[model samples]
Target chain A: MRPLELRRIPLFATMTPADLAAVATVVEPVNYQRGTVLFGVGDPCAGISVVLDGIVRLFRRTPERREVTTGIVRAGGLMALCALCGEATHRDSAEALNHVHTVEIPTAALHVLGQRCPHLQEQAMRGLLERLDAVNAAFVIAQEQIPVQLLYLLRSVARLDQAAQRHPGDTMHPLALRLSHAELARLVGTDRATVTRALRLLEEQRLIQRKRGHVTGVVLSTPDRKVPV
Target chain B: MSDGGNRKVWYLRHIDLFASMTDEEVEEIAHLLDDHHIPPGVALLDHRDHDRVYLIKEGAVRLHTGGPEHQVTLALLPPGRMFGLSSTVGDADRTINATTLLPSYICFATWPKMAEVFARYPEVMFQLTRSLAEQVFRTETWLARLGMISPTARLADLLVELSDEFGEPSETGRRIRFRLTQADLARMIGVSRETVSRTMVELGRAGWVARESGRLVVRDRDALKMQANS
Candidate 1:
């Protein structure tokens, strides 16, 4: 992406035109098709990748070979700055949830840019902290009842839609979730059967909606908030 | 500065975030830090407050979440390690509670001081980023084990990990110097105290680990390693 385009991203928005131009010089644009493994666990971090388009799911494989979905990075979000930091190795694997486009900045160059623009460092740190908070929150949510946990998962997914629709009038938009029941179970740390049962309970309470045995959409009368589970 | 204060500065220099810094830079950063001596069982950071970061100088600390009955130990941080950065990143709520596992000495730096340091030495920011990444990796690994492994394997894995990270060579074998009770082990591995007791019995019968004076000693490293992977 061009320097002007990079300025729109919050991480780079604070940089001066000169600094943005400098950052654009080091920016490498890359694309991946759906289901592409952008990086794997134990792989050395190539650099920091900022999502310009599409979604990337960061997950870990359990000893049983089951995939535990940790969190999602969408357009305008940065992926795993932790990897670029001291360890220099990815802690988990990242795969594209759909056709993905990213602007990759080498760690070395990013450090240079950080020196010139302190806000860049602040923004990246804030992003990392936010992710750490989300992961820890999920750990706590794992202990709650299945239906409560499912509601939390649904709200997490709906957060993306809520972010995409920032207009005040769009608060009532129907948020369509694209995850399967099995996928939802994985995210919520439960089995498919439990997820199915919990979905019915949530539907009974009018907390969520389903179509053809899959959670297709949800309507939030207010701006989406984290439902305590 | 007093000798003790000088020693605190020395400890700060060794932290990964300040390791690359020059003595002058370290001294400059050290001026912004305040030393604290936290008693065992006292919380250094509450889950509700997330404004300061601390670097362990003398003992260990446990990072946990939830109330007393449902607490889960997310990590056991040793000397030279930093905690509370997640709070300093933004106005985010502290995700974990940090309690001193033993009488500990730590250096506290508020978010503003930390930000000033980062601005002066961007490399320190890079180092902090790396440290946080390592923590994320470790937490992810623990979560994966909790979800996929049996309770026996989970306890075995935690023992081995703690031993590797904090153990000292003893005449008999490797002994974990820190005081870890069955309840602590259960919290660390996300199991019940009863489960930890039973697993300890199993491990003890196998001659893999033994407890002495409230500390765990690993007798057969290979056996414990085998059980952890099994």
Candidate 2:
């Protein structure tokens, strides 16, 4: 796999050239084929994984063996930083959704690098804070609507993917997210029928179009007007 | 109520359960205050064990599942929020574990003291009951989300709730400044990590929201509101 440019990553955007170089030294690159397990639930804490390319899915299996996706990693983002600070092991497993390129940085080295690199430290701390905030909201999400929950998830990934792009604000930039409808339904905690209904609803509204096995030609609707509940 | 050892007067005053007491009454109740410094990362209450109630004098408290993974965070309660309120009514074990976010002071109160207060002061009893009811409502709302809704709908409801609570007025409209991540949403919705990933992609492409700095910027609050509706 071709190496990704570290300077282009939003998580690294604050880094000076020196800071970037320091991070490059510590992040060890590795590649995995599709459907490979990067880590398993209850596995010992290793370190954080930064996706250099491709995609990795983090999920946990229920007692009945149903796999639920906890989140995914494309290039330019970090994963599983919260577990490393404490002794808790991975609560879920990470599997490659496709051929993936990633950099694994042990928690110890990353902490040292944080002290050495201001940008890296800021990034790591910010990520942890973000995770904490997310966990706080997750508390609320565990109680609410599934489709809304799914929408927030998509909005987050889309933003991160856009941020990781070389030109973030350019209109020509489009996020190509590939996943199937069945997978989409399961992630949203619904079945295929609900997914199809929701997708058709979006299609009728011109918010999106479906093609082949993946979603395509996406456009966000305008900001909604506040309606009386 | 009790100045109790020259501690700050506000600590005694702010707690609604203690707020109305006169200095004498506060001091009398202060006799019940058992101060202890809990070290960081220790569990104060175990699941299924309802031994005592803690009033947080200082320090942060987080409620987590009693399971092995402890992946789920139920809530983060700061001072003024009663810890272990459930124990005030019954002898059941705690449903969640209370862990100190920082090394801090906690007042250990027995059920007897709690009963004394409730019986002696009908006002305190009323306020405490109302507070407990609100918490129960919030807990039920959270469980309902995890048990019923899809991830996107759950996320949408969360956004609506956040927007209602914390959203600020901006040229773009009421913007929720708090940031959240996809992984967090996945865990919250109890779905696979990939499900969150794909759903987020689909939503973003459709302009329901925009992600920024790991924050879900609600560019269209109305659209989100519609999606949030069950």
Candidate 3:
């Protein structure tokens, strides 16, 4: 694997050039094959993982063993940073959706570096704060109706694939996660038929479109989808 | 802060975000804060404004989004909790709206003031990061319960948890400290007010709970426990 670039991760974005050089030596780049299970729920969280390439999905398994996705991370996304909150274990399992590459920095090392590096912990906290905001929104959105839930999940998928899309703006975000209705249903925490009907409704409203040349590809008609959700 | 300057230092000492700071350093940050009281229902933080930091001195704040008919309640924060993470997060955008759930005394300061405190006492920044991380877990725990549980079970479990934290012994049962409306209960459990009202009626019929002078009384602890676990 290539050496990790400390500056690429938002948690280390504020480190000065000298400080960044010092920090780069601490992060270890790791690559996982497609469909690799990165971490399992309740496993001791070793440190934060900063994605450098490809996508990772964080999910939970129900009592009946159904996979329900909580969030997604692509290149430049950070995972397990919440361990800074002193959690003992990973709250949700994470799996690589493709051939994912990430840089792992031990929690203790980051703290030690924060003590030496100016504006490091502060910048990291800002990133975590934004994540807290996203999770807080998810808490509320989980209770909403099916259409609202689908739209919200679509928006999240749109974000993961933002860099790949040529047309980027407020409206019509093309999705990259070519997941089937069953997978999308899992992401939205619903049944396949229900998700299928909801997608059709969204298509009827022109809020999304089935992507060309892919059976399961769905694109957000408008990324800034304002609703009661 | 009607009690004046010394009192400001007193409140900052209690906030978890500043728990690692020395009393002298707490006093220094206190002097820079503008303390004010917010009436219930008054919006405290606008999502667009990210340069100010708020530390709750007294009462509660509701972090939420959406409008009247479809509003979603995020978190009901208690005293000693800090908001507006500019000192820790830098120039980050806030996603949720915060409003006073009760008449609240809040101490706020510009990001520059907070930045100086963070720079001088890096421990305070560490504390805030840990605190926000805890908030993330807390919210996720709530989301999991709200998404997966039955309405009856959610209410029973909520009442039990709230009672554990805020209940006091009464003649017939334990009385919850706060006066929570059906609407409030509904919001917390991610159910409808009608559902809460209907469930309350059922609980009342089953001798599980009662309303005593507008406060909720858990009349049968064992029964509520059984229902909660079921």
- Where model 2 places Cα greater than 4 Å from the true spot, the runs are A1-5, A10-23, A62-65, A132-150, A163-175, A225-229, B1-74, B78-230
List lDDT for all candidates, in order: 0.75, 0.58, 0.73
User: Candidate 1 vs candidate 2: which has greater TM-score?
Assistant: 1
Candidate 1, residues B37-115: lDDT per residue as tens digits? 8888888775455677888887898887666777777778888778886532111332467888788888888888878
Q: Each model's TM-score, in the order given?
A: 0.88, 0.47, 0.85
In angstroms, how far off is A185's CA in candidate 2?
A: 2.2
lDDT string for model 2 (A139-201, tens) is: 444334544454444444454454433443313223466657777776655678777776665
Tens digits of per-residue lDDT, candidate 3, B1-230, equal: 35787787887777888777788878778887899988888887755566887878887777766667766667777787787662111012224567886788898888898788788877778887777767776676566656544688778877887677557899998987667789878887889899999999999999989999989999888888778666
Q: What lDDT score goes with residue A152 in model 1?
A: 59
Off by over 4 Å in 3: A1-4, A61-68, A164-171, A211-229, B1-3, B39-41, B46-50, B85-95, B164-176, B203-209, B217-230
Ranking of all predicted structures according to DockQ, beginning with the best and ending with the worst = 1, 3, 2
In candidate 1, the residue pairs with backbone N, CA or C atoms under 3 Å apart (3 or more residues apart, or in different chains) clash, namely: A85-B130, A86-B130
Candidate 2 to truth, TM = 0.47
Top-scoring candidate (lDDT): 1
The DockQ for candidate 1, computed on C-alphas, is 0.43
Please give the ranking of all candidate structures by lDDT, highest first, separated by commas: 1, 3, 2
